[model samples]
Target chain A: MIDGYFSLYQTRSVNERKFSNFGKTEIGMQKTGFIPAIPDFTLTPRIDQVGAEERASRFTKRSIKKESKVNGLKLVLNMIDLTTLEGKDTEGKVKQLCYKAMHLHDALPGLPTVAAVCVYPTMVRTAKKALLDSGIKVASVATAFPSGQASKEVKIKDTKYAVDNGADEVDMVISRGKFHAGEYNYVYDEIAEIKEACGEARLKVILETSDLITFDKIRRASDIAMYAGADFIKTATGKVQPPSSMPVALIMLEAIRDFYYKTGRMVGMKPAGGISKAKAALHYLVMVKEVLGEAWLNNHWFRFGASSLANDVLMQIMKEKTGVYQCASYFSVD
Target chain B: MEKEIKKSSLSVSENGIEKKISPKRLEVLKTYKIYIGGQFPRTESGRYYVAVNAAGKQLANVCLSSRKDFRDAVVSARNAFAGWSERAAFNRGQILYRMAEMLEGRKIQFTDELMQQDVPKAKAEKEVNLAIDRLIYYAGWCDKYQQVFSAVNPVATSHFNFSVPEPTGVVSIIAPQEDGLLGLISVVAPVIAGGNTCIVLASGSKPLCAVTFAEVINSSDVPGGVVNILTGKVSELSSWFVSHMDVNATIYCEKDSTVQKMMQDKAALNVKRVIFYDKINWNTDEGQSPYLIMDTQEIKTTWHPIEHIAGSGGGY
Candidate 1:
């Protein structure tokens, strides 16, 4: 009787169902007017039931294998002094590092070169000249690095000059004083104007989520940057201690998911600096995959702005795939 | 034992006035009229029907009410609804309590009328007594229905939100025919309890007791014309009342299932509430409770804060 009554009610209400117009992809189609069916364990099991002895054996072996890989990925690449290079004690350090990368390129050929040789905007010319024909890109931190408390005209001029001088990417920091003062519309417009000045240069909008100190604020900053035409959303300026965490990354990924749904445009995500571990990188990657799906797994959408993360991923993957632990002494520290 | 029974003779008074041998008597007839527009006027039809005693003797010639009376009753109800619905709930409570007081005073009078209408003595007394008590039951609920049904919802932070109880105006109640006096009081009390005025159709075949119940209303401090009682065919009035666009809701308390369904179908014209009293045992003590009145009332939910946001500049 209850079933009959429910069926009657359903028949009467059949015409009332409405549809939502979002993306036209398969995921979008499934999301619109979708009611999830209750899962039955009789149809499928969620996890394999392993015995205590086998689990203990696998856990110990996994721990031992993980330790050796982390120790090897720690490459202490001494940062070149761009500020001291005004005809003062300029010792061809950029040349030395380029040559070292050339020699060590074969051993860790799969590893990424130190996230594009970061340098001062003035030394961008020197780095470009030294690293020319080496497949390495020049990344210049523009908009008066460290503190972005400058006029819009000066910031725009600074960004345009760096980009015109052949910088592949411009990592610009938001004006934290105005941003912290709840002047988000101002911050958004400034970032948009700076990105426009970059013209062909890839724009990385630095939210400094650590300084913002709240997930809600971090999420809002990510949204604001994306709305104002940011090519990529980056976590911080790498100046604050405890620069980035999973919650901050989670918030950023969620914002991207929502923004993409609204605008059908994907914004790349970059977690720069303080991301020194392979496992931490994989964890951030897992968060992205969980929230934004497999489309964000590629290099075009996902970038780790660290000098060391690529080497660590290779070390861990090699150990896991080969069933043998390789020590740190096999590779030279570049 | 035989002594001469002499004829009584009249004695002449010293002031030349004759002593009265026979006592003269006079009868003052009571006038019964329809209370309309705050005045008691006899039916314009100028026709009357007989309300006979149980011994098949004529008691009085009562007015034969017509559809015009029902329409006039509706007009009275619509006029009273505005002022009554806006009255403070506690003030309504006081008025209802006063109504109960007035009904209790006229208890013996109602019982006598019920007896004359052929109701068994105990049952007549019980119906009259319960009618008085039913008023008190509803009177207490004037202020409580709001608390029970209304709520202050925490809407997702965009604005101030609230809801409160309001009346569905001008109900047409078809009082139950079985338990005449109590049923009439039962349906009418709840409709007016929530500040809604009503035009009630008394039991057609047995309207004597119903007409007497109106006397209680007239004597009580009940606002004139808030409740207009009519004694006519249910089929005719139910059709007219149910289809009337001005009537907000209807309550059908008669027992005939066919009439119930017919009234229900006709009631759909304006979607009047056609209640079936057979579904309820009107004799049950709980049946006559104020729940009947409150259940029919629409509770509007009103919500607001008990305090205002307050702060100030001061020396720290």
Candidate 2:
């Protein structure tokens, strides 16, 4: 069943995929009522498990020293989406997270604020009000998040509620049960509807690659989200074990690279969950540079869906400046 | 006549066919690695230095642990503090006694390692025995030091005020540079017996026994990271050991004034408790005192609320 899902990508010739984009924006093509043929869901390019893992490991070996390390650490701090999606989240907790997003180590001058503060739909208004005038965007998770097990009306309403509360970005989860059941059309139409509900807010489609399991399915899901007008593709909701490993992230990055080449639009990538270490974040940046080049290096094109990563990057920067390792007690707890 | 006798030892035949003879055997040397977080790992920097005795013969290739090694050790020590500090005092005594038992079974190895660092045979044996006895001394204090030190204050109020000692969390220690086995034990026992975890840098010139002692510690019931031992230069690691913010105290056993002054200054960074053991000899009874265990303990005082006055006739 999975092999046939990938065979669809094999059926579409590169020339045909590129010829359809003769200077037409993917969104513009949609407005003209010309929907590209749905992926055959019968075939995809098979990912070499060993080769992908080997390539991803090499990205960690490049010595990012002295100047590059400091700069990379700061960039990591800026590209973070400080997330708090707990069931016990309160208005005060969301406000505190927003404050951390803006004042990340004010002791160190000239540090950029994090890109956004991610919260649930109920807390979006509180975050939006707390982070006002800080220039940090507010992102909310919708579509029965972490597990997309809701009806279409409720899911669309969830996205609209967050967007109505001034969420700049809507992070919606793809229905994993349907995707795993090989209901590719159901998943694609659902993402397209969420994209419409998002309106002006950029939509991030979470594939939850931990549940997807294989590199081939992750790649196919990335293709599905991109064609269905997802502004960004995120790996997980920070709610699963073994979330956002390098090999799975590599497959998604390759998919983004291919999609950018075939279609004129560029889709951003976010490998969230389990990315808490400063050194590991730098390695992810190395993977982005190697796989998708420099275009996806900034907050506009890439983001880390993390909360703890901010403190680690701040600590590394402090270690560079002060020549001493930092204790977690010194940093504020989220 | 000498050449004929030497050839006969090999038993070469007159027909030019060599008779069966044993090949000369090669002696294998041990590579002494540092212990961190319960596992024996080579120094992360992959650097090593040759340790030699006073006679100028090489003893072993010891890990030249870098500041990064100290950093890793501090992390392990910090991670282990919670469980080790909260353990029942009697259980901690049992574990320390278990360590002594492990050392007793391996005294010959410890004695040999001490002798390899230039101590005479009789002195080496004596030092090993002293080290084992010191472990027992600390094991007994593990459960009794609080009773001797704790007191109830006579406050003229309804509240009852009392103070007791608690472990001072992770400690960074530089073991004494003399009598390799006994000196390391003297410093380590007191710190851990008080319920604190520590990362110790063994004697630079005499490091063989430190690694062997780590082996003994691994087999004991004492948890990993409770006592991490690193073999490296004191000059390179002293500043990092004292200045780490997470370390609650710093112990320097040597009497070098400049390093002592430096440790005092750097310890101020985190207000770490700095201890000096420069003038003491580990082999004496002074080294086995219960006061050594009190050095790394914090005296916590609490006031209990009472519903009745202490001496009122109708209060009871």
Candidate 3:
């Protein structure tokens, strides 16, 4: 185990170049990625729970209005990973969802297609086929998905199946039980193995922060995922209570920001679940702007993992266009 | 006398001592807001009109609800439609009766509001009594109106053909210009009693009792959004109330011919049912009927394949 750590550190140092241009940056941290050391996981920085909540709430007060509001709404629509993760989801449902993903609102022209369509592993092939050439990616939740109770071999197989079947992105859940048991190495190695299994597909690691429970645990888990080769750190599985709150999102966004500063590589953030309103989605956008800057504003770096958010943002766009409140009855129910 | 107040403050002697009271000790005036989804939300437009009496005394600041307010109320009504329309007929009757009970309990409050709108003492009392009685009348009809209106069609085939009344999803109404309490109740009772939910624009000039009636609904078992009351100009809101795609029916009780023409034209956009109750005197027998309930209900004719067993034993 010691030899494995040393070899990994040596290869990492040889491959890494100097991380530049962040010397005079704010929130000063001068940690170089090519060090002969990996920081201890137990000593990850503690979060001021009260202060973090207050800061997260402050993001909501920024009044995004008129032209900017309309633009923000469109951005929110564009950034959504239209998701349908149900036990009863069928091929027909996936096809319909993919169609909705492509044509968000055909009545309103010049709208961008959503970032992606996220589904369970079994539906990846159908989603990929339906979404072909539409510029919308097909993301599959693997590694036993919402509950990561399966073995490592089973998880790898799950991810390979989704990838082999043409999923553009792979979303995986971490072993929270293992993490809570202080087996950080096991959690870290599992993520590393899944990242390898993903091959060319981008991997979004679901921390399932609702299960993590505390800010400290969330922050530490975020550090572990980012270090273990996660392409994006997502908030929840959409099946938990209090799924992806602003504070939890804030902590994750902060983690992504810190990771970028330290390694000079950008990772995406998807705050999935419980974010169904265009107004709240815009607030999330505003938080991204303030914390992660304009570079992360695009769908490439930031995405909303939601199903119902697309329609609401469409309604808001139409309200701006027609000068009347749009009804949900008028919109197609997916 | 200094008792003639400015704004809301009054000068009164306390314990026979002439004490100088601060303006902070002013009489609290009620803020009459629009009711949507069972909550008293100020109009999203942030505009209000001064409702004055026949003596030209300013009664209160009533929310001059805009089209957005109407839109929100329609949304609330549509959301409530599924649950309310699916409720058992007897339970709907129970809720309507509960509404009447709450209104009876607040009879004095509504009567005072009617009097404040320049109604004579006897007339205001009568209006309150009539409103309560009308609610009870509708409550009684809630479970029975269907049997009266539904028909077992005589079909030539072996299929059982029947036409039953279902609550049209959402109804928007421009209530009467007079009879603030009674007119609202007369139109609103029959509509809701039929299991439909509605957004009603109360009598513009005398809307105090409508706001108070919303209070009665809030306290009653009557679900929120079943009957949302908005206090505003009918002219300003009637077009929106009818033109809304979500509203199944539009009821206008005003006699303005031009407005009626505009409403009919706009209501044609969605092929919505437009009802004009302008000729009905709510105090008379013409006001209460199962037909009023049928105004906001849709006749669903179902053809089920079964032995023709209908009307074989009924009324035998």
The superposed Cα distance between candidate 2 and the true structure at residue B116, in angstroms, equals 1.7
Question: Lowest summed lDDT over 10 consecutive residues: which window, candidate 3 chain B?
Answer: B1-10
Per-residue accuracy of model 2 over A69-154 as CA lDDT, tens digit each: 99999999989999999999999999989888888887799989999999999999999999989889999999999898999899
Model 3 residue B72 CA deviation in Å: 3.1
B215-304, model 2: which lDDT tens digit per residue? 999999778899999999999999999888788999999989999999999998889999999888888898888888899999999998
Interface Cα RMSD per model, in Å?
A: 44.1, 1.0, 2.1
Q: Runs in model 3 with CA error above 4 Å?
A: A1-38, B1-29, B307-316
The C-alpha lDDT values of all candidates are 0.64, 0.88, 0.86
Worst-scoring 10-residue span by lDDT in model 1 chain A: A38-47
Evaluate residue A326 in candidate 1 and report its C-alpha lDDT on the 0 to 100 scale: 30
Residue A210 displacement in candidate 2 (angstroms): 1.7
lDDT (C-alpha) at residue A148 in model 3: 98
Cα RMSD (Å) per model?
34.4, 5.1, 7.4
Per-model TM-score versus the true fold: 0.42, 0.91, 0.87
Clashing pairs in model 2, backbone N/Cα/C closer than 3 A: A4-A42, A4-A43, A5-A41, A5-A43, A6-A43, A6-A44, A7-A42, A7-A43, A7-A44, A8-A43
Clashing pairs in 1: B162-B303, B163-B301, B163-B302, B163-B303, B164-B300, B164-B301, B164-B302, B165-B300, B190-B293
Q: Give me the runs in candidate 2 sitting further than 4 Å from their true place.
A: A1-38, B1-28, B311-316
